[model samples]
Every structure is written in C-alpha cells, then in structure tokens.
Target: MNFILYAVPFFVVLIVLELIVDRWRGVSNYRLADAINSLSTGVLSTTTGLLTKGVGLVTYAFALKHLAVIELSAESAWVWVFAFVLYDLCYYWLHRMGHERNILWAAHSVHHQSEDYNLSTALRQTSTGFLLSWIFYLPMAVLGVPLLVFVSVAALNLLYQFWVHTRHIPKLGWFEWFFVTPSNHRAHHAQNALYMDRNYGGVFIVWDRLFGTYQEEDDNDPAIFGVTTPLASWNPLWANMQFYAQLWNDARRAESLWDKLRIWFMRTGWRPADVAAKYPMAKPDLSQFRKFEVPLDGRQQLYVALQFGVYVALGSYLMNLADSLPTAALVLGWGAVAFGLFAQGAALENRPWAFRLELLRLALNLPLVWLAPLAGLWPASAVAWVGLLSYSLFSVIGLYCCRNRITRLAS
Candidate 1:
C-alpha cells in the first residue's frame, strides 16, 4: 500500500520531463552536483526508513490500542475525508515546529540545503525525521483514526507536496489561497529576510494563513533558495549531520550548564553569546549569494549520472525486498548505498581519493555478487550475477577511458 513506491516510476519520468523543459526554456534550475546530492539524501532517507520506521509504527499502534476513544473505520468515506484533513492539520504543526525549533530543524534542514528549486529538491528529505516526526501524529491514534486511513492519508499528503517543488509552475490565483503551490512553497524555501519562516503547510496553505505565517511571493523580491548556512559539500551524510554537528559543538563550548541544556531546545539559530563570539558562523549575505559549483567536464558528469542510476536501481530493489530481508542483509544493502553515494559525492567534489574509493566500491561488489546469494542478501540468479558483472566491468572501463580527462581536470 506504499503509494510512493508505486509512484516512483512516474516521479522519475516527470523529473526527466522537467529537466528537458528546463533546458529548452533556458532556465537552469538543475545543477548536476546539487541534484545528485538531493537525490542521494532522498535515497538515504528511504533506505534508512526501512530500519527506523518501526519506532513510529509501534508507537502509533500502542497509542491506538490503549488510548482510543472511538474506533474509526477505514471503510467510511467520511472517515477518509476527515482523516485527510486532520493529517494535514497535524502536519502543519510538525512542519512549523521543524523550522521554529533547533533540534527539529537539525533534521528538517536537509530539504532546504539545495540551492536549486526543482523536482529533485522535493526528494531531498531528512533521514533522521523518523526520530521525532511520528510524535506529532499521536493525536490521530488517540482519536481512533484507523491505521489504514492514517497511512493512506500520510502518503497522499506527501505525494501532494511533490509537484510544488518545481520552478515551472507559477501561481494559480484562487488555488494559491487554499493549497501549497510552487510559488508559495518557493517562498517557504527561501532564505530571504522577507520570506524566511513563512508558509509552513504541506498539502494545505490554509494553516499558514490561519496562523499568520503565510507570505505571498513578491514580484520585486525574487526567492533565493537554500539555508542561510550553506551546505557546500555534495555528501548527503555531511548535509544531514551539518546542523546537528553545529548544535553539538555549540553545546560543548557553552560555559553554563543551563546554556548547554537550553541551547538545543531554544529557537533555531539561537546560540549562547560566548559560543557565538568564540565561533561566529558566517551567515551568507543573500544580496551577494552564489550557488556552490565544481568544475567538471561532461565526461565526469556522465560517469556520476550513470553511477547514481545504478544506486537508484539497487535502492529500488532493496525497498522491494526490505520487509523480507534479514537484518544483516538490510544493513549490507544500506552500507552499499552509503558507500556509493559517498564515493560519488567525492568524485563530484574532485577529491583525489574519490577515484580510489570508486574503484574500491566496484572491487567490493565482486565479492558481494559471489557472497550475497549465500547470505540471502540477494537472490541466487544467473541474470543478477551477469548484471552485476556487466555493471562492474563497464564502470571500470568507463573510468579507464575517462582517466586522462579526470586527471587533467584534477591537475
């Protein structure tokens, strides 16, 4: 019943179509490194959810069992209607708090790190959101909303938000008043002084309007996407950990115990005076802003794209097999994904160690193909074996052919 899985092909197709439109229209909303980093964080989030999702599910189930006041039926059309609206209401608070608070923002900031506003940026999600996101929806469980209805509405809400991440869609006038559209959502994503911390709705913008947090997109002031503290690296792991690491460092440097304890729960961007003075974080001046970029030839771009495609395939396969796979198998699959993403990030950054790490990934895959079936990590199929071999062979040959180009560029 996971609609996102079923919608994955359509998402891929639409992203491709969007890219084509972007190129044709002379609007450069898709940067190779940024898009890859966005999708990599998304892939990491989805893969990590396979393991951490139990926390949310178990808590919801427990609450529903003991705390339910009235049992809601999924079979009722009215129940579906109510659940859909209620879910969004709950989501509004979660979304608002995610931006307003420090610890939650640490997890939520992954989505805002992308400098470009495009379809890929929609997929850029936080892997750690499961740690606290489920807490917001306990109300639904307490009110006796059926688990089936809750899950369905949650997926629908998420799918509804996907199209709003595009730059191609302009405001839809009256529709803009009720729902979250590309224009208003873009304002929400902006770091502009006028646009920051406004429009915190997912499927519905009414919540923001009601709560006095809504900001309409302005013609004079263009939206500048990305967080105030830029995530300069292409690495997804680093992107997720960046804010949390900053919070941890600030906490450690605090002279007062109360300051150390309160710094985390305080407003997002609030720092102790001593910590702020000692380590003044450079906030980007939006008037003189520039998107992060790396010099890479077309060959390197193609190679990174191909490798990312492979990871996407593997990630899809792992998701399909997630429930059936043993714990160790899931861990191995997740590790492979992390490694691929890490090495690719390095390659995009033009790091000298990237080439060696990529080679190591391919070499490691050979043994994985041999051992996976026995470990029940992968199926024992001749075609699967051949496919892995073919991929490894071609990747090595591709790297070899592109060696001089990579070296010359690095030099």
Candidate 2:
C-alpha cells in the first residue's frame, strides 16, 4: 500500500496549520513561489516514481529470492521492530553518501535547493534516487527480512520525517538525545559551515550520535537553509537538472581523461583542477545572503495559485490510478502534468513568454480532454470531459484577467 498517498490530506492540513503558526509568530518561513516550487518538485517526483520505482522493487525481490541466507516471517512483531531499526541504519549511510559523493548529490541535491525550510521542503524529494538507493537495503534482503516488512518500515520512516522540517517546534529536552526532532533536523538542512553535512538520520538520532556525526542545534549560530550553490530558479525541471548540468559541463571542459571520469565520483563540490582554475564558481557569503524572489501582483498570484491547485488535483488523480494505467496513458499524463508545472514556474519567474505558454497549455487542454479518451488516457465519459472543460474554461478566464499584471512584470 502507498502510505504516502493516504497521508496527502494530512500533509496539506499540517502545511496550512504551519502557515497559521507562521502568521501568529510573524515569522515569514514560507513564500508562495518557493512553496509552490517545492511542491512542484514533489509532484514531479511522485509522477516520475511511477515509472522508476520498479528498479528498486525488482532488484530487492531478486536479491531476496536468489541470495537470502534465512527466511524471516512478516507476521512477527519483533521482525517489524528490528526491520524498522535496521532500515534507519541503512538510510543513514545512503543519506550520508548522498551528501559526500558527487554522483549521488546530483540526485539528492533537489531536496536541499529550497531556500526556505518548511513542511513543503520535506516534500521536495529526488526523483532519480531509485537508481542507486536500493543498494543500501540489500543487507535486509540478504538477512532475510520479508519484502512486506521492508517496504512498510521504509514508508513509516519517511512519514516520520515530514514533521521535522518545521521551525515551529523547539528541542524536546531529553527526547532530543534519542529520536530525530525538529531542532536537530533543522541543523541537517543548514548550509552553515558548523551544521553542514550533520544529522543524517531519518527516524533515530541515535545513529548520528553513535557514528560521531551528530551536532547539537547551536542557538548562537542559527541555521541557514539551502545549498552553497543556490538553485536560484523557480523551475522544477531546472531544480532537478541543475547539479547534473554543472557536472556535465565540468566533465566536458576537463583536459585529462582521468579527471573526466573521476569528476563524477569525487567528493561533493570537488572540481577538476583545470576546470576549477578556468571556470571558477564563487560560494555566497552567508552573512550577506538573501533568499531568491520574483515579485508578482495579486492578480498574477491568484492565477498561479489556482492553476497550481488544478495540477495538484490532477497529480493526485494520476497517483491513484498510476498502477492501473497503461504505459502510453501514464507517459501522456506525466508529460501533461510536467508541462503544466514548468509553465507555472515560468509564470512565477515573470518570464516574458510565460503568459503565452500558459495560454497555450490551457487551450491545448480542451482538445486533450476529448482526444485523451481515444488514446486510452482515460475512459470516454461525459463527467470527465465536462470537468476538464470547466477547469480549462475557468483557468483561461483567470489567465485573461491576470494578463496585464503578469505581462507588466516582465516588461
């Protein structure tokens, strides 16, 4: 079962509650564009996972079947408890390596690109993590943990992490020493020198403490969220591709063959000597740091928010029927969703072409609604057509109303 799917409503509620807390405290921890971009990456990740998750599941099943040394029963309570603990241990190393290695960081950096640390940041996950993340849990399969137990524990570990992304909660006295909490997890998200690469645990803070990786949240030196090399864009597609694009350019510029090959596996942020000397990248001074922002008028904001809502609703629908959908339908649905998110990001950035692209997307939806059923994207039903037509019509009206406000910003 997809536990995350069931938890979506709760996640939305808590995010709203967090917003309320933010207003009450007069702390601006969330920005509309940043939050939307964070969620855009998250929705993209979920949609992408539908096609990629088989990589991990297939490999784990293969390992469990051909290489298991013992058979563990899923029915035992002790097995569930033990698997949960052991999964955290495996996760610690995966999470650590994701920061320490360049190749892994290429995938993991998506989560850290958000300048603001909030509950939405927790949802900003790596879509490509399935490629290598499964290797960390092979031990569980070899040690005979049942597949059901492994999957359940993994989901539970992830769900437990959602609440820790907030600044509203303080250190919970003695509880801080054992399990992961908001305070310590905040340190993990920090880009500050003192907090960089610390607190890698998912559920238990014990792993970090035991492994000498733990660092207490220092009140004097507060946490600064986001990576040193800022994403600096609201585009969800660019957010995922930013690091890999950098690595690719660096690899192409390197003079030596060994430097080209080794660049990918080197420590995170390590560049070739030649590339470093010629194409220098400067790290921002944290003392003078400012969050990335693009101004949008009220009309534009409402239009973006309404359109984002539509995509979120569609994304949820895609997630629900992902398993049952045909490959062609899934790919088409994902492409449409991805394009919608890209357009929304462009709108947020106040790009000159954003308004036209959005108009095109809305116009295309009319034909897509009718054509989709014929292509096996959805069943031919009046309800689906009417629902989609109404959505497109309303969205077009909103876009039309926001035209002057949106276009003037780019001017």
Residues 5-56 of candidate 1: C-alpha lDDT, one tens digit per residue: 9999989999999999998999889988999999999999999988888998
Model 2 residue 375 lDDT score: 67
Candidate 1 wrong stretches, greater than 4 Å: 409-411
lDDT of 1 at 309: 90
TM-score between candidate 2 and the true structure: 0.97
Give all candidates' CA lDDT scores. 0.92, 0.93
TM-score for candidate 1, please give it: 0.97
Candidate 2 structure quality by residue, lDDT tens digits, 1-411? 999999999999999999999999999999999999999999999999888888988999999999999999999999999999999999999999999999999999999999999999999988888889999999999989999999899999999999999999999999999999999999999999999999999999999999999999999999999999999999999998999999999999999999999999999999999999999999999999999999888888878888889889878988999878887777888888899999999999989899889988988888788777876778999998898889888888788778856567769
* TM per candidate: 0.97, 0.97
Runs in model 2 deviating more than 4 A are 406-411
RMSD of 1: 1.4
The lDDT, on a scale of 0 to 1, for candidate 2 is 0.93
